[model samples]
Every structure is written in structure tokens, then in C-alpha cells.
Target: MISNAAKAQPRGASRPKGLETAARVRKAALKRFAASGYAAVSMREIAADVGVRPGALYNHFPTKQDILKDLMLSHMADLLQAWDSADFPEKMDPLERFVRFHIRYHLEKTDEVFISYMELRNLEPDNFDLVEAERRRYEAILTGILQDGAARGRYAVTEPKVATRAIIAMLTGIPNWYREGGRLAKHDIEDIYLELARKAVAPGATPPLTGDRMT
Candidate 1:
């Protein structure tokens, strides 16, 4: 029963005009920044990608630095929010739940992950501090989990904070070589990494050396 005019409106036209344009700008910038380093992408290119005038882009973001800052901070915000809503079972092993959640989330956000790490150097000092604060907040979640697990004799982590960083680096590296339709399914990869992570922190467990046994 919808009228032709209603059907003809572009998708998301119901959103406020300014908000829609800003979303488009962020999307365009994320793609460009992921493909090319943040320092290499320009505001003009982002505006053009969004089908907006360069001057119009300025209305939403006063400068290119603002856009980069927004992208990094937004990524971290989404990450933290996702962890909050992950809804793991009350009885689940905290380390297992965290490993599964982190791997699955980062796999789905490879571009955001790419720019978050690769473009960090391009953020202004003030913006860098803001984003770094969010990063530390996320890291604190894992560190807390590690501390609890160690206290309960469930894990062998000597330094919870250091182990948190090592685990995160290992999990986030999956995106570098992961691809759709790969030899290993996504869940398979998750299981493998989870086992590796488990062994890494298991009491008195020695990690297997490379060329030992992997299938």
C-alpha cells in the first residue's frame, strides 16, 4: 500500500539528514583509511566517496583529524559495548568466553581492526590519548578476568596485565591471514585459538613448540 514516492526515497531517508550524511562519511572514511593509511587519505576523497561537497563534509567534521579521531574512538566504543552485551553463561569459564567473544568480534570487524591499529600513529596527541584510554579500558576487562582466574587457581598467568596484552595480540592477528572459505572454518579457527590460549595459561602446561603437532 506504500506510495511510489515512499518507495523511491533512498534507503535510510527517514534518518535525520545530518545523521545520515555523517554515517556515510564515516563509512567512506573507514574503507579508505583501511585500504590506504590514514595519513594517505584526504578529506576531499572521503567527501567525494560520500557524494558530498568537501565544504559540506566540514560541517560534520571540522578537520580530517576529527574524522580519524571519531573513527578510532567509535570503534573502541562499539567494541566495549559488544563485550557488555556478549551475554556469556554465568557458569562459563571466563577465559573461554572472553577468547570466543574477542575472536568472533574482531573477525567481523577486520577493516575497523586494521585502521584502529595501523592508523593510531596518525591521530593527534589529544585524540590519541582519548582512544588510548578506551583501549586501556577494554584491556582492563581481560586483565580483570585473568586476575580472577589466577586467584582461583584456574590459570597460571604470573602477570595478569602482561598476559592480557599477549592474548589480545595473538587473537587480533587472526584477521591478517583469515579469509572467507578458508581451509579452516571460522568456528574451527576459534576452537584452535581457544585451545592454544588455554594451554598458554594452564597451570604447569608447556606450550607446544612449532612443528610439534598441528592438524
Candidate 2:
């Protein structure tokens, strides 16, 4: 279980009103979306949560769907920015850097991470396309890392893209079960996951991945 002492409260109504109304709406929506599925949440409820009348909510987000789109888009953008700024060691192997940086960055953002995965089906078609494109861009970063590692004989990835997806799935699943002070610390968990990831693509783990199996 994550330690209560280490956990930061999810942004909520108690926050100072210094934030712009739109920013407050985004923060409130994130809390509500994570607590209730996107389909079950309504614009009125979000407006109430943010201490605004429903009409005022429209000034910032014309529709509830617009709010959902903004939440998902900003989440992805923040994730990318966090990864870029992570204090990865300059001498670290690309794979090791990726593993550590990913786990550390996401552990601090459980709510955003949860909604990013659980609420995608609620996105409208155009919004879905926009979010998916950003997601693919982030995934491409990992794919490129795997390809580079393979070319250097550091990893035996048979399909860089497939390996990228697999590794991400494994890492992203962390927030589902992790707590701040579980039987293992975050660093210990990161190390264990890193070893599992490293071996999965190690030179002799499995035969070359097939094109059809590139899922």
C-alpha cells in the first residue's frame, strides 16, 4: 500500500482560487473523472464541483465533451514534458533510463494516469483521433529507444514497435497496484520491473517476433 504520508491529495476544492477558472475546471474535472467514469459524470456535476453555475462552465468549455478532451490532451502533454525533464543520468543506458524515468514520473500522477487509460472510450471521434496521435508520438519515443538498443546489440528486440508496446503496458500497469509505502519502495519496484523488461528482450529470451504478432 502507498503510505498516506507520502501521498499528495488529489487537487480539489480546497485549492486557492488564484488559478484561472479554466484551470480550476480542469483540476476539478480530473478528480471527478477519476472517481466516476466519464460517461457517468455530467457537466452540471463538474460545474458544481468547481463552485460555478452551469452557464459559467460553458464560457471555458462549451460542452462536457470538450472538458474531457482537454483533460486527456493536457494529461498527455504533461506526461511528455515530465519525461523530457526527468533527471536521467547522462551515462545511463537508454533502456535503463527509460525504465527508471517512466516509473518515477508516473508514480507521482496516479489520477491523471488512471483517467488517461480508463476514459478514452468516452472521447468523440475527432477528439479520439487527436489524443491517439499524441499517444502514438509518446509510444514512438520508446520504439525508437528499443530500435537503437537493438542496433547497438544491447537488446535483442525482434520488433521494436511491438517491444515498445509490451514494455509500456508493463510499466503503465504499475499505478493499478502500487502504493507509496508498500512492502517494496518505489525504487525497489522500479528495479524489479526494469529487470523483467530487460530480460524480455534480451538476446536469447525468444525467437524473432513475427509481423502478425506485432500486436
Give all TM-scores, in the order shown. 0.88, 0.86
Q: Count the backbone clashes (under 3 Å) in each candidate.
A: 0, 4
Residues 1-107 of candidate 1 have per-residue lDDT tens digits of 99888887864575579898999999999999988888889988998999989999988999989998998999999999999999889998988899999999999
**Alpha carbon lDDT at 209, candidate 1:** 51
Name model 2 segments beyond 4 Å from true: 1-19, 207-215
Write the residue-wise lDDT of candidate 2 on 72-182 in tens digits: 899899889988888867898888888888898788889888988888998899999999999998999989988888888888887888889999989999999998767
**Whole-model Cα lDDT of every candidate shown, in order:** 0.91, 0.87
Assess candidate 1 and give its lDDT.
0.91
